[model samples]
Target chain A: MSFAQPRYDGTSLALGQQSDEELMLAYAAGDLQAFCQLYEQHKNPLWRFFVRRGMATECAEELVQEVWQRVITSAPGYQPSARFTTWLYQIARNLLADQHRKAHRRFTLVSDESEALESMASQDYPDTITEQGRLALRLKHCLGKLPALQLDVFLLKEEAGLTMEQVATIMGAGLDACKSRWRYAVANLSKCIGMGAPADD
Target chain B: MTEEEKRLSALYQSLDKENSPEHVDARILAMAKQGALVHTVPLDVKQPSRWTAWRWPLSSVVSAALLVGILFFTTSPLLPPEEQAVSASSYDMVPSAPKQARREYQAMPEQKRQLAQSIEREAAAARSKTASVLPAAQISERLAEVDRLVASGELQQAGTLLMSLVEEAPEAKARLSEGQLALLQEALHRRSTNQ
Candidate 1:
């Protein structure tokens, strides 16, 4: 999930062009257009962040709704002290943690490597499904197999476009710990997808 | 990140195109619109002008001043029609009396001053015909006793003292401010109702 640069168009060119922090401040000051532009920019990546973390589609939608509702209700107290994405993902991460605490089931890996590969091979790949397509499905299963902390680090770093430091802040871990988790996530995911160890090592 | 990590990131992106459902977007946007409506004041826009900002405080001050003026005027001692002439003259004779009357006399228009002078002459002539009454100081002491009686709930004694003060000194009520007179009357009324 790429955090795309905001695209400006129509009458909202000025507001749409603002940095996320500025847009949030405008939203806090009661600008609906600014909020709408912000929501459009982030809604998908935010939803995908939860979806890729093994949350059910309905649960993901519900979390997305809750996260935005918190953003709206808490807008008045928003300060431009940090990047808006950091604040947004912090909310999402906290909500996900809360959901996990309540369910106690999200941490269980849904498939093993044998099951994933077996399922992948058994499902007749459509003619148009490229070599990369099979691996993408397999990699997703590999993500489920990652330690909860490593997956959280990897997902926040990659999916939310946060820097290692920002990811550390959101995950409440040290920068080096987050980097190690990311590297481990990458190596683990690579092995699951048959890419083996990082060639650079 | 190494080449392998880059490639894996690319693969992940390929599968990451899922969006929140359309219904969710509609519900959230509608909520945002409704929220904006409730928060009518935009902090960044429509700054209040100096006058606009000051209007409420200024109006409050003016209202307070008007309230004080109304209370002062309504509660001031009011002389009956007969005493008005004598009171106007007596205001000059008693230098220790409330300075408010003298200040009012000075502030009065020329026509009102002329009327006060004519009334003063009539009062001076009538002064020779009637007996001199209790001084304002003595009347004030008696009024204070009435207050103490009312405070002690000795309304029966307070009423007798009040009637005697009125009978003995016809000018006593004129000396009592409207607020003091109203309180004395209330105490007397309470005594009669209790019987």
Candidate 2:
């Protein structure tokens, strides 16, 4: 069960066009290009996954680095029973869980009106870009208030581009439970951003 | 889900596109490179190969030591019976040549007096012992002296000289000329007549 073994000569396929699983296997075998490509594919999503969970940029950066490090460290033992993204997100989720355990809080809320306005006020806002940025900032403030489980599912959905099934698998819950979390997160966030509460099912 | 819900999700997606720091990428890549090298290497192979590497030289040294041991054991019995009978000397792997020489001198006199008396008493014994030992030149000189004594009519001296010559080496008996023998016989007869 190698996460990153010296090199996997399991398949001779071209790395650039390979599947995520194939790239992971190749990277486990010490194929540098495969790792780079996998990194490129997942870096933004992983970073955003942490940031959207209300982690500071510094904290998110450390977590992101840790997730990738775990991937490298565990490469030798990587198995293909589940999807590579499933395994990758599981590591990130576990790290986030650990952070939560240490802090005794899911995340810090945008508690102060002044700080939210201050954070949003410092950055430039011009035209539609400014408007979108403002709304996004406002939504980010509201996201901080969502329940931890819902917020996690929502972030995994949009940030990691995982399917409902994948999110459920990572969260270690039933598919219906994942759906419930996503709906609650969306509704709460929508109301906070001045959209009306979601319609009843 | 409603279009608004979809809009909200899409807007959340666009909310942030943060990237990982450069150091993170560099660190992970470095670790991966190290791991790849480790995968190819066999860690425990060195000690056994080190022992194997010395095998040829070690075997040669062992073989040389065995040969020397066999040679020593085989030649150890060469010590004479008296030396062999001694318990302490039995442990000597190499009986020294100079020790045997010393032992021979202890039994033999420092000078030639005893050797001369022994030869005089038993001419035939000395003859056989010295046959392969003394050089030919010394024997020739002794024969010439005997001839001189016979020429000068010193019959007693000539006869005494003959006895010494034969004692030194009995083979010198054949060195005397017929005239010299006849002169010695005449001298002996004259002595008997005088008596």
Candidate 3:
């Protein structure tokens, strides 16, 4: 599922190293190559975010595609007011909320753990196993058990590699509130995975 | 913030690559390329030059001026002041067709009006001169023909004939026999009352 980046060839070479905001500004100014670069950068993280957002049992691919489509449609008016990933994720969140409303589902903070367990259980593991792989599997189980909001905060930060302020902007909350959410999400996830709460104790 | 949090974040990332599906990627990339090609395509709608941008407002102003010029010429004092005043005043009211025709008639020039009246008078005089006093035999024969038409039940035709005889006005009917005159009058009365 990895979308190998389009070769940074010819006209795209100069824009390849530009920051996400710079690339977005260029895309807004009718540079599609810059958009391709941004797309190459974000497509995976965005897809994973959709899959792990606890609604992958639904049309995760379709939702991910829709997120990219929105990115394309909204390119003309895009502003560099915040990080491009923040704006992109914010668009993703809005689409997610739209899907929720369309399904007549309430906005609750509980991940459906059974679906996550069933998906993991279907994958027969190889006899060869690494310690890190085992830990990741255990963490995935804990993620399903995490309350929906904490998992959301944790996943957004991890998936986008976003700063607290950027996460706050995407979540429509103050930075302090975002930090508080992130801290609680981390502590609870650590406890669930039997990782023992951090040195903050 | 914490080593534990970094480890947790790292574990989360390692579970799966889980990139967008191939169909999804292909679909989105195709769209992105299509959009790029669209923008890169040669455009029929050229970028507006400074003058081109102003063309609409300038054309609008020119059109408004031309309309004003036409209005001013039509209402100017070069035409008869009284006629202009009357038209301008009437234009302020919502007039019907009859009123508009009446206004035009009232606004006719005095010379034109006198010529029209003279023509009408001459036409009436010619009509009167054409109506000669008929011999008694001819009058009696015409009355007999009217009687035949009335007998045949062609009341409308009989009425038309009666109207032509009376075209010179009511006194002209005095030439007919009393019975024929009574029959013509009755036919005319029935047609008129029915209408």
Candidate 4:
């Protein structure tokens, strides 16, 4: 189920008006309003990250709430040495890692079965979707075919817009290794989508 | 650039076409407000200090020390009267009658008092022995062990050991002596520069 639509007056009094780091610092100083703004800005993109990663829609929804809760709990002591999104997805990566470890031991991976189920459940859609939406969906499906590490690198780079160095830091790998993962991810996605890469962009 | 590199670059552009959802701004603000309220409510009830984070463990240790001290003091009378007087008088003077009364009080439960005193004496002896045996040389030796770990390319292990030393050290010098800190700094500098 979708979350209730957040109400916003035109006034922009919430954290949406501020930079992520500014909002985080404000939240640290005991401003709950700042956290709400930060959450509002991140929730959908964060949810989509999990959704495109082929998590079950229900699982993605639950995980999105849990990630926000963690952000709220940690806001008081946050020290932003990097972009707020980088710090956030670092937490998300860790949670996803734990979930993968548990899931690996419990289930065989032929495909992300839960994600396939969610896609099947959403089949009653109009054919008049925007071109961008169609392309994004196609890309998402192709992304699911890559190895887990490559997919993670690709998503962090493309969706989160982290530099390769920052992605390396988050992945706990040397820079070259992260770059290689990204290269592999992109090649695999292009091939799977039958685009074989756009000629000269 | 190679075809692979070109492909990757194009893929990156394709991926960048997506935008963050419109609702994210509102959700983050709401959550921020809730978080601020949670933090403020607790402070209203009790003003927390920077050190309150350490209070649970500190208070736990203090409570344990007080408990042990009480046990030691109460069981002193169960020892031979001479030892009791020596230990008690070393700390404070009480009336001779009160001392005798303490003996009589403990005599009614001699076995329990004897068992407790035996345990207390053993604990006290163990603590004293530990204090006496911990030499500066032993601390230096531990630092040397950390250096060896660092030399072996086990930086993570070395870092963990160094962190524990910093935490447990009585003073800055004691926690990470000048030599050890210098060594650690050198290693970190080397790694960062090399990278």
TM-score of each: 0.55, 0.53, 0.53, 0.46
lDDT (0-100) at residue B123 of candidate 4? Answer: 76
lDDT scores in order: 0.77, 0.71, 0.70, 0.64
Taking the tens digit of each residue's C-alpha lDDT, what string does model 4 give over A1-201? 122223323235555566787777777777666666666576656766787777876677566666777888887667666778878888888888888887773332323433442343244436897755554556666666556777778778766777888788788889999887776565555554444532110
Ranking by TM-score: 1, 2, 3, 4
Better of 2 and 4 by TM-score: 2
| Candidate 2 lDDT by residue in tens digits, A1-201 | 233322346666777667787887776666767878888898878877788767788798788878887887777667777778888999999998999899887443323232443444344546666767777877887666566787788888888888899999999999998998788677666666656553222
Error of 1 at A129 (Å): 2.4
Interface RMSD of each: 1.1, 1.9, 2.1, 3.9
Ten-residue stretch with the least lDDT total in model 1 chain B: B85-94
- Candidate 3 chain B has its poorest 10 consecutive residues by lDDT at B88-97
Question: Which is better, 1 or 2, measured by TM-score?
Answer: 1
lDDT of 3 by residue, A1-201 (tens): 122223222354477677787776666566777888888899888887877756663488878877887877776656566666777899888887888889897644434443443344344546588867766776776666565556667878888888777787788888887787788777766655556642121
Per-residue accuracy of model 3 over B1-195 as CA lDDT, tens digit each: 679777777777678777677778788889887766654555587788999899999999999999999999997687587556544544543264388766775677978755655665577678777765555566566666777987998766776776666663445577676766776778778878989
Report the C-alpha lDDT of model 2 over B11-119, residue by residue, as the tens digit: 8877656677778778767766776665445546755577698999999999999999999998877767754544233234125537775466455674653464445
Restricting to chain A, the TM-score for each candidate equals 0.81, 0.80, 0.75, 0.73
| Winning candidate number (DockQ) | 1
Choose the strongest candidate by lDDT: 1
Off by over 4 Å in 3: A1-13, A107-130, A197-201, B41-195
